[model samples]
Target: MTMKISIERLGPRRMATLAVATLALFNAGCMVGPDYHRPQVRVPATYSELPGWTQAEPNASAPKGNWWTAFNDPLIDELEPLVVVSNQTVRADYANYQEALAEVRAAHASLFPTIGATGSATRERAGSGSVSSAGTLVNSAAARVVNSGSLEGNVSWAPDLWGQVRRTVEENAATAQSSEATLANATLSEQVALATAIIELRTTDANIDLLEKTVDAYQHYLDVVTEQDRAGTIAPSDVITARSQLNTAKSDLIALGVARAQYAHAIAVLVGKNPEELEVAHSAAMPALPSVPVGVPSTLLERRPDIAAAERKMAAQNAAIGVAVSAYYPEISLSGAAGFTQSPLSGLLKIANYVWSLGGSASETLFDGGLRSADVDAAKAAYDATVANYRGTVLGAFQNVEDDLSGLRILAEQADVLDAAVRDADRGAEIAFNEYQAGTVDYTTVATAQATQLSTRQTALNVQESRLLHAASLFGDLGGGWSTDELHDPRHPAAPAAAAAGSVQGGATSAGSGEEKVQ
Candidate 1:
């Protein structure tokens, strides 16, 4: 219903009372939608791969510190912190969060009245042939000019009579929360990437060091064989074989440089620098493999930022259903305008020149070929999709954590076996060389033993790298110590200091390595 009221009939006090009553009625309108409840999800009592997993004894009483710090590598500690500040991907997501906050604020604005003012001044002129103001037909119309001015202030509000605006604000607020969680997830992911790159780079350095020492040993063997040939003990063919082995080792050592340089370049980029702009110094040892504490499955729901983001989206979508349902009700609005208009250009603000309007409107779309119903259906469908997405995300998170746990557990056992193999191979190579010198074995036997030693040593290095990489993977899958509770509200953003304490705070199982550094 639309109405027009004259000031002469409805007095100013009555109009004010009407507006107040309208506000009260709308404020009491029932919110029409399903309230959000976290959907039930199947969570395991314990991680599937937790059995026989080596849980780390991280000092709980120790001051909170970075997850990478568990590796005890200064380089990793320094570079890992930079990923959040300078990573372009994280920065882009943060910009997206800023936009989401603006959207929330915009939606919130709809819950209140909109006040505006308008002012206009116009000059009009009439000459011959123009009708006179008195509607008289004069033979010669005299030149006349009139000036008019008007100033008006108006207020209009829809009042959320069926809670449509409130529901919309709820939806946008949830969306902003999801955006914030997404930002945290991105930051965590990039930081893990940086840590992984640094770990691999250090592993490469260790490999290069191993090859260098092997090359040196081959050179020494060649020298001893050359002397034996001069003494007429070893044949010339054996001398030639020794030289070939030395040259092969030298080539293998050189090949490792290519990989080392590439890993370094990758590390530099991960730290937000051009490959050439930054260089990681070669460390003599690889980082220590950290033991991850494997927490129960249910903790993942709150721990993973991606999970939090997905859950928040479900809420936002659910609110959309309320917004759609609200369309079934009539839109009730109240508007009032007060102003003065005068043509004499003198005392335009006088009571005689005052003009005012007080009105209300109720518009119901009685026929739309089921548009509102279709919209409601579409909203419900979208909401269902989000629920599925949220569950899938949770399942994926569990899969990641389990995969990391299994890899670390299986690899740690292999590391132990390889460590023993390396020790045995070292002894065999020593014995074979001594037997050749003592005229008890052939030079070919020495070469075979030495080859076995090098192969086993290289295999051990590979396994060690695998373990470290898996540890980092587990750290990330566990949400990198983030919690949904930390997700900032759009209406009340928190400061940086309010964020999580520095720590790799999560439960993970063991991928423990032997008591050996990268060497």
Candidate 2:
């Protein structure tokens, strides 16, 4: 007697169940490697250089929508918006941020199983000739053609047994965050540049106005000296001196046009226009410098985009350490395929022609001449570098705030003193010219006093320009109204919308809320 066994009799259903159980067991395994923790950084309690400065109350100094509007300059308000959308450098940074978001999504995709399907058809011909073991032909006939087809579905999953995929996802997430911060930094930088350029342009305009007026006055003096020399009331050398002063003033007036044109061209590029297409009309009126609110130094970490970027980079590098450490363990993958096949196309889907397979694989590097160890060490070194960079960025951010603060404060005082000096110099120039006309002083003394007046006036204008530039720098150093809460995970497209809707009415305020505080 003989016994016959069938797949059904051996319980194929039970085998399928066991395969699923095995897959579940592998999925349930704990991931290897250390969990990520943000690196600690020391922060100062208060700014050292904030003497005589009042700290803004919570949310008091926060920039409202469109920080440039705070300056009350209509031109800046108009140009600042263009930078967010049209500036080439800002646009490039935005694109880079989008790419980083895509990378984050790609990394997230690895956490789940992948399913695929395949189908194929083939026509084959089989020879009818047969041969014996001795190589003697038993039969010979014409070949016959046949058609075959198959359809298959496969599933593959590499379980995160060593947390490699998870760590990769974390790394990419941090990188995307870093990219977002970079985008904000780029935008802020361009906006500040545009504002600074505009301020300088206006200063040039004011300088040109002053020089032109001086040129007109010098021309009148030249006429007076020429008439007096011809009448034998003044020496011919006085006429020559007067002509030289008029020409010098005219030259100074002409030189200002170059800076004005260059600034206008820069503004045009920043607003995404051709240099020749955009023109800013000359205006002698300078916009009054707006008061900027400086928050506490501890908030600098949250307020500065560059600081945020550096911190995110540190987090990313920290996750990379886990990725490198995970290599010490094995990579386990589960794969299975279910299919239908038959010699004829009509029978491809029949239950009797069905086929399936289930399998699991694990691979690990046994030895690679200490390459894995070296990789881990390298990752550690890289992580250490980022930590140092992050700390350095924080220090730099504080320094920026301090430098701007001290600059504004000192410039304010200097402006006051220079204002009085300019008035005194102008009065002295008037006195010297009158004394020369009365034959009490030489024409050379008159020229010296006028030159002193021009120098003092130009100095005052430059001081005012410096104050405006410093204010713009302070705004940028304060993060240009960006906050960590605005950062969105690309994996969730709606996350940013919800966050924006939930954000405070104004821009970023206190640093205690939102994403994890570095301090």
Candidate 3:
């Protein structure tokens, strides 16, 4: 007597055993690559330019998140949100981050077996044949119809022996993080640009208004000089000078409209509209310059998205080295198939005709004429290049902050002097006009005074506008302390400081190393 075993009796037990075995195998798998470590450069002990500014009380905390609101500009606050939704470059970076996340999932998926199920039915006919029976020769001919069906499945998986799959996943994850930071940087820049442009537009409108009033005043003076010339009280040269002065004032007023138009066009682009579609009323003038909390220099790395992105890029490149090194090792994969078949549909589920197969395969590059070696070398060189770029990015970030701070300081001082100059010129012009009206001064003196006043007022306006622009630059350089903590979420591939490795190189500690600070 023979005993039979059915798949139904053994399948569950075998599956559980295989699952445990697979888990054990993977748990035993060693990740074969050097973990990433961020390189450190020398940071200055203190900023050389912060001497004159009033320092905040020691250990005093500035408000976190939404630092731009400190300016108290309602329009600027309102426009910041539009950058994330409407800026084209930022949208593109967000899409790239999504794609990178999908790639990571795709890589992680390789650790599991791909199972596919299939079914089919078929019909066939068999021809008859001759046969001999007993002592006499006999011919037997018959025809039979047959039907067959099968339910089947196949599975395949690749074991990560040299950490190739893990490294690939790591690379994609880091790239995704970089892309995420890039999006944040783009959004921050757009917000800054839009605010700066609006401030500039308002300033231009103010200047235009000033010039228009100055033109009107000069026209009044021209009329007076014309009347005097008609009455034979003034020379033709005085009339000529008065007309020239009036024309110059009119020209300056006309020139200001050009800048106003350009700024309006920029505003339209920021809101994702055509230049002709959007129009600002230009009612809001520039407010007082915003005060920025210039945090410590080391805090910049935490705040600045670009610096974080550059650092992540280095991590991605480092992972690439692992992927390339993995090429030198053999690739191993496991595959399996199981099915049941029968000549008739009624018997298709029976165990007697069951079929199954299990297999594994390996491949290695025995000789490639130096191709694999070149690939590894190329990966290492790429990593080296990224390290250099990361260093450059840090330096550039510091330089930008310093430059903007210096500009704000210098421009503020210049604005004070220009304001005084405008006041002096205004007084001089009033005196000259009064003397001209009283017939004690020539029309030429009045013309010179009017021109001087217009020039000085315009300079003051330009200087005021420059101060605002420089302030915006300073805030942008500081990353306005944007939060990238969300990106570092393991669920989120774009964690901002995911590449930080928890500390700086050589284990040297800094002031705010443990704090959640972003540039």
Candidate 4:
């Protein structure tokens, strides 16, 4: 008689039940670690500078979801969407975010059992010399085949007993969120760059047109002076001066073309194309600056992608501190394996031959020469560093909004002055031409008036371009219309209201006299 022993402790059904119960228990509580809370940062209630700008009540209107669309430039709206999808920097950031997401998934997977299926087949024959029990003279040995197949599973869950897994998940999630914010920021930047480049390119084209017309006028004046000299009405020296002025004006026109080409090339690169392949033949006219509405200062926290990214990083680092601290606790793991085996292939399916194993493990680092403690200290230090960095980012964001607002406001005023200068110059040029036509003024006076008028007009156009660029900066710093909802993932800190308020205070110095149109 043979004593039969059942080695399989857990049946397939039992193993499945255990796995489900374990998962339920593991998931039964709030994730361990310090939940993030936004620390207080000083921010002013209103902007102090309202210099020259008529102050108005703060507009509580949320930023237009697509702030650039507020510019009402059809081209801008058409191009910005592509920037988020195809721009290289945004693509790279998106990839990083996916990677972080993968890490979180991997970490989450560790909380469950690992299952596997295994099979093996083997053939064996005994040698005559090795077969002591068989006939010594046996030259042939019987061949035997053994086949086995088993299904098994193992579980090793380091219970968040100390919250290590939770903290790690928190950290990874924050990193993933940060990557998302960074991607948004990168996309916003690309869109702004393209918008600004197009504006500058158009401005260049306008300048070239103005310079060409001025060159033509100068050439006409040169011809008149040459004819007068031939008739002995003007000296040869006067004719020479007229010719030199015409040549200089033509040279300026050529220089303007070079600048235009450069701006075109820049725009081409922004739109993801080679300079030679681009054909932006927009000769219509320079775009008008858009009217920008400043919302409450507190809105800055929700609108800026950079600030959101920084805050996410802070959240990640905060979780890291918990991860470091969790190292001090014991780690618990539950493991189990179940399968079937038999000497005969037919017996493999029999319950009697089934085999299984189950176990639990607990461990803690007994000694590491204070290394773990040092790591905890280092993580805490890193958390502090991130806090400081987050605060600095918020401060810088406020400063940027203020700077752009001041710049745009002042540029708007300057444009008004430049408009007057252009008008005066045009009148002077007209008067000079009339005098020349009457034979009272020399060709030199006509040339001077033409050059001055053209220069003033070009300057005015350049200022208009500057105003548009400053507006772009203002829009960008204000967060490209990203909302606080986008910035706040419930897993992280609340909106930084003080920072937003500070931004408004810093930006609010100048108000519109009475809703004057920017265009």
Candidate 5:
């Protein structure tokens, strides 16, 4: 007589309860490594270069578009928008931002389980004389055909036992924010470059106008000298001198075209057009230097996109440290599979043909020869490098603002002195010409005075151009009116949802959190 033993299998409800308990235990585990805290950076209370500067009152009614519109050129207003839509460099950066956002979504997805399904069918014929495992042979005439099929569904999940998944998501989200800032930087840079090129192109037009007038004046003098030579009152050498001045002025006027053409070509490329396909008509009117609003130096960190990008990169690298630290812990994964199988199609739907499994696994690098330790060290060093880069970027932003301010100030002073010199030179030339016409002085005196006047006027034109160029530079250095807030807005389609959420956190902590305030 033999004793019978029985065991009960868990029902679906009991299996589900067990799964929930396991998940709760996994969720309760503490995450490894440090939480991110932004590194401290020192910012000046006030800008040294802004001693006499006053902040412009916020204009609620100002056009909420391209910052270059402050220059008040209709052409620039029309062209600046094209940089966002068409500039190749900006488009590439936008694509990069999109890719970064996709990466963030991918990382976030890792926090949940993946589910899949599979099915297969096969047909087979047993050999005529096949032997059985028990040493039984099949007759050649008794061969049989067999058909088999199976269907399966599976699930796999590696829970964030030590916050590896969360850390990765954080890292990718920060990287997406950085990419968004980079796109903004690229757009602003292209707009600034286009604005500067337009300013130079307009200045070239002004110079060309000045030279044409000088050339006409020289021609007039040449004709007068020729008449005097015919009357035997002035030497033929005077006629030669006047002709030489006329040709020289003409040559200078022609050379101006080279720079003007190049600037036009650059503008075309910036606006996504071929060089030959775009043309800026000649305009003698120069754009006045607009008054730029330079806020406090502390604001530069939030105002400059490049600085913002560097800061976000530091945050991403900080998250990466947590990801690296998580590697020291075991990776626990949960997997489940359910399927159906039958040797013949007629029995495939029977309950007896069903199969199922639920299981889990844990893996640890018990002996990695210090590889995990090296990874953690490398991650820390990378974070340190990003911190250094962020600080350097902040310092460089201040330097740019100061440099542009000083340059504009000196240029304004030089313009004043040059204005006076131009007036004196003009008067002298007028007097010399009157004397020559009255036969009180030689043509040489008149030629010398006219040449001096031309040089002085050209110098004044150059100073004006410098002032415009410097103003454009200052606008760029001041972040082209971009705020860090723009990096997170959903209305700006380039921004990813992850970036927007992270930026919200950044903004909340920016003022009162006592974590390094990036303005």
Candidate 6:
């Protein structure tokens, strides 16, 4: 699947959240933990099976966006675009990515202060009649009513004093980027699956055509044998054999419809539609085998979406270590309230009735039974785990590329051998038929030759189908023209540390700077 319209589909809230993340990314001071760097993986300089492979030159005039068009099949071209747009799995991954971006914004908000307003009103009887003896009558004359009201505004901030908020924002931004890469990986996988199903369906169509022609040929053979049997020129068993072969061919032809229908249904669901709603047309011609370029192994690091996602996860986990380390530092909080209060709701806005308070405090974990130390150790362990996972992903990507290349090469050679065998088998069957017609050979020789021809032809067709499937798989393993450069960073262009620090004043005043304070 391709995401040409990804940004447009995300609503305004998503866009706004991303903007907040961008800002906070540029507003933080020095983060507490280790900065992120990609872990080293030992990659072979070249693909093992692509020793003589020629590098493809980019053509500005040709379309690189849809590489599957190399197959030159109009049907495939029509369906490939739908994988990113309508595929249910792709859409779900996209939603998950959007949610991750929103989380980044939530994390970004922690860098600012919190402001709130409150208002209240009260009504009561302040005085009552002194007479207990004549309570009811005296209270009516002596009772007094009072009304009071107050309005207040308050602001509180703990500051990102030790970069905890910044590190958290960093972690979430990395996570969001990871989610974006995951979406890309899923879309590509679904697109490849759809292409493969179509290839199988096309192969089924070819198989059915082959069987139909075979059935017709057997029918003709049966008619000739029946005529000869009636005249006592051929054995009655030959007639029975011919009829049985025709019936078997017909049965095989009928069975292919089930597989064809299943493949069509799978393709429909892959593009996000009900099976019954889709109508697949039969095309006897298979898509041509495409030439897939196998680049050097090191390029997979920047070319594969899964590798990018794994790398970003490492970054997120590394930032988590910073978030943990930030715990060791002291936290400072400042709060202020300003308001007016008065009796009887009179002069409530006057200077004497005004009330105000300003306060601040600082706290540090004096002792926690090694809890903070445990947290730091856990975060480091998690980071180490992600590093291993990232390297493992890179290794897996290398394996995918190598496997596709080797399979395609070996399959090509096998396909050549089968094609040659098919040609010889066709000639052999023709010769046997001619000899039998001239009474130089028995009918059994003709039957044997025809069966061999059919077997060889079927095997060749299978190899052709396998080659097409491998071609499609090759495109997917090669990242389907994706690049790590396509991944968006909320803090792209990497702002200088001084510039990031300078933005603190604005972030404090406008967005309010604060994170969860350690108690």
Off by over 4 Å in 4: 1-19, 27-33, 49-65, 126-136, 139-151, 433-447, 487-519
User: Please, what's the RMSD in Å of model 4?
Assistant: 9.2
Model 3 spans > 4 angstroms off: 1-11, 52-65, 129-141, 438-440, 489-519
TM-score of each: 0.86, 0.87, 0.87, 0.84, 0.87, 0.86
Error of 2 at 90 (Å): 1.2
Compute the lDDT of residue 332 as modeled in candidate 1: 87
Question: How well is each residue in 1-519 modelled by candidate 1, as lDDT tens digits?
Answer: 966645567777996797677677777788887778888889877787876433332436221226778788888887777766666677677778768878887987887789999988889986665557999766655777888899899999888877898888889889988988898888888888878888887877888888899889998999999998989987899988888998988888888888878877776666556666665667887888876665667878987999999999999999999999999989888788989999866788999999888787989999999999999999999999999999999999999998998899899899999999999999999999999989999999999999999999989999999999998888889877777777766654442223222211121212133321221
Give lDDT per model, in order.
Answer: 0.81, 0.79, 0.75, 0.70, 0.80, 0.79
lDDT of model number 2: 0.79
CA lDDT for candidate 6:
0.79
Error of 3 at 69 (Å): 3.1
lDDT of candidate 1 vs native? Answer: 0.81
lDDT of 5 by residue, 1-519 (tens): 975322137777887786677667766567777788878889877767678544533645322346687777877877777777677787688778878878877887787779999998989986667777898875766877888899889999898889888888778878888989898888778888998999888888889999998988888888888988999998788888899999999999999989988998898888776676666788878887888767777778878899989988988898898999999988888788988988875578688998988777999889989998999999999999999999999999888888888888898999999989999999999999899989899889998999999989989988888888888888777787777887663223455655544322222211122222100
Candidate 5 off by > 4 Å: 1-29, 52-64, 126-144, 489-519
Best prediction by lDDT = 1
For model 2, the superposed segments whose C-alpha errors exceed 4 Å read: 1-31, 52-55, 125-145, 493-519
Cα lDDT over the full model 3: 0.75
RMSD of each: 6.9, 8.2, 9.2, 9.2, 9.0, 12.9
Q: List the residue pairs that clash in candidate 2.
A: none
lDDT of 2 by residue, 112-183 (tens): 789999999999877787889999766656557889999999999888776788788888988988988887
Query: 1-519, model 4: which lDDT tens digit per residue?
Result: 865434358666885686677577766644545678877777656554454444433545434546677666666666665555545565566667657666766766665556666666544443433334754544344444455455444445555566677678778878777776786788778888988977877787777788778778777877777787889877688778877887887788788777777877776555555566555665646665777766556667767888788888888898988888777777777666666766545667677876767677888899989998898888878888888988898899888878888887788898899889999999999899789767898767877887789888988887888888888888888877775465423232332233223122222212223322111
Which stretches in model 6 have alpha-carbon errors above 4 Å? Answer: 1-28, 52-63, 137-142, 491-519
* CA shift of 253, model 6, Å: 1.1
| Better structure of 2 and 6 per TM-score | 2
